[model samples]
Target: MDKTQNPNNNEMVIDLVDLAKALWRRAWAIVLVMVIFGGAAFGYARFLVTPLYQASAMMYVNNSSINVGSTQVDLNDLTAAQSLVETYIVILKTRGTLEQVIEEENLPYDYETLSGMIEAGAVNSTEVFEIQVTSADPEEAERIANCVAEILPDRIAEIVEGSSVKIVDYAIVPSQKSSPSISRYTLLGLLLGAVVSCGIIVLLYLFDDQIRDEEYVRQTFDLPLLAAIPDLTGKNSGSSYYYSKKTSGKEATP
Candidate 1:
């Protein structure tokens, strides 16, 4: 092979055919490891993590004039009201509001943890907003959602003057727990683990210098193989002249 114009260049290219061959050679090991790891992950996810119930409530910016005496609500004023509502949604999950929720609910968790559990966001391109609360206790999740829904407007009003946001829908007692998504996560883990296992196997196989196949021998050295010598074992003494004499105790086999 030339230094630049190599004769073996065509054989060194990587493609699907080469990948398929490598994976086929190592399929059993990949499948076994994927199954073991996938099962372990599924088991741990299903059994180890505590289940949490999520409760959500819908609220919207009322945008109605605080002064009933006013004749009309300005469009610009409504836009500003929506923006303010978004700000209040961010404020809803703050330590102050969360601390109040903790005190009102008598939750076992502290303020910091309770703050972490509350999630709030506005529905895009609309006045509607949602508040989600997660808890190990389903009723408590609902209670927290409803509590925030009921109390948040007043809290906002106290913080910002002339606000008119209201709850359109209250949180209902949730029927489903949200954690331990075993089916989806387990399948994902299996796919990732299998790919990684096969990748490592193929890489190691390619880097290894052991002569495992006729292709390896032919590629490493251009030569013609004519014959292979047989082992001079005593078991073949009847068919071989050298081992026959050793078996007859006349001489030792080479």
Candidate 2:
């Protein structure tokens, strides 16, 4: 076979051993890339990202009314209170309630900003609802939540005309941040780095055209028995020669 010709050049055959060897040769580069990306993600999550704290207060809707004659609580009033919990959640974030909270708390923020920070939701199917506030400052978050708790009950009483709202739990300053998960970001960085490194390795392997071993030569040319000439140079120098015989049994060395 001619030295320049290739027999197994169909482009569909894949040799896993060659692929593994190629990746092993560049293992250090892949590891370095992985470390760099993972460290960058950790640093960004730990130092660059702003952490927010959340504070929450719980309020209960009590629509129960006493019968003057019997002095017993009305069942229909209690059921009405349960249904009003959802309506109270909507009113809690309204401009009227939020502006009152901001004014009472002396917050240096507008109604929109205060409203954006406040979250109110009914607790399951019960007549209880929770109000939460998130801010960069823990104390501010707690203060805002508590102020909403204090003002919303009276506001609800005025709006519903005899319905009662009571505070069940007061907001406290949160000790821990609510977001910026370091471990999760680091793991994502690791996976991203590994995928990028593997892609680079694959690209390099596909683009490389140099044949590094005798097996590649034989596979490319579909050649029969042939002697190999080993290059001897530098400190590992030894010997280099080649011999081949023709059909006439005449031996030639070059």
Candidate 3:
């Protein structure tokens, strides 16, 4: 059996070099569009988005009080205390503790809302842990964090017998906002700008149909070369050039 048939691709050929050239020629326009989008995004994020502030209190778990005559906690005791960090967190999040915080602070938030604002996590998986409160008002965040710090140990002792923790650092009013980072927002805006600008350029390149020179005809139609025409002006710049009726006036002979 003869196997001389070559498979035909039948795919339309795209000139990436031409597309690249077209994009390069309109680089300034693309950059302008990108800047406009990026600036708008930055402005929206900076001015419109609500910023959140975080205040945290650092705590150290101390189980030594339960170990009579022990001056310092052992490694095993510390490991066991680390295990109780979650129990302490649970006690801190109880409806009773949260309701008390709201009552003492006279917060407008209810149990559920107040609970949602507080977060607890272990630091480096050791006995140390942090209680963070996030709120729109920085002072409120600090107050809530401190309130939790002051109340957590008592709550833990009530729930877990002979378990206690000490405050390493009290919550302080944060000077800066935790959320709505301007740099991150600006970066996202720039990425959006690049995508939008590049998309428009690609679309314009794909939709353009104007042909330039004999090369276009030969490649597009698979046609053989014919007799060439000579340019008298010797300034042929192809379809990319526009033949304008507006002409540069000749300088008067001095």
Best by TM-score: 3
Candidate 2 per-residue lDDT over residues 82-178, each given as its tens digit: 8888888878878898888877888999988888888888788678988889999999999999888888878887888767789999999999998
Model 3, span 1-254: residue lDDT tens: 11111225545556677677877888898788778877887898899999999999999887754476768767777778889888888888999999989988999999999999999999999889999999999999999999889987888887778778999999999999998888788777877887888888888766655545555544544444443444446576322321211134322110
Model 1 alpha-carbon drift over 4 Å, by segment? 1-19, 65-75, 212-215, 221-254
Candidate 3 C-alpha error for residue 123, in Å: 1.3
Give TM-scores for every candidate, taking all chains together and pairing residue i with residue i.
0.75, 0.70, 0.80
| lDDT (0 to 1) per candidate | 0.72, 0.78, 0.78
**Better candidate by TM-score, 1 or 2:** 1
List ranges where model 3 is wrong by over 4 Å: 1-9, 64-73, 225-254
Q: How do the residues 186-223 of candidate 1 rate in per-residue lDDT, one tens digit apiece?
A: 89779877988987977875565543333433344333
TM-score, cand. 2: 0.70
Q: List the candidate numbers ranked by TM-score, top first.
A: 3, 1, 2
Cα lDDT for residue 54, candidate 2 = 97
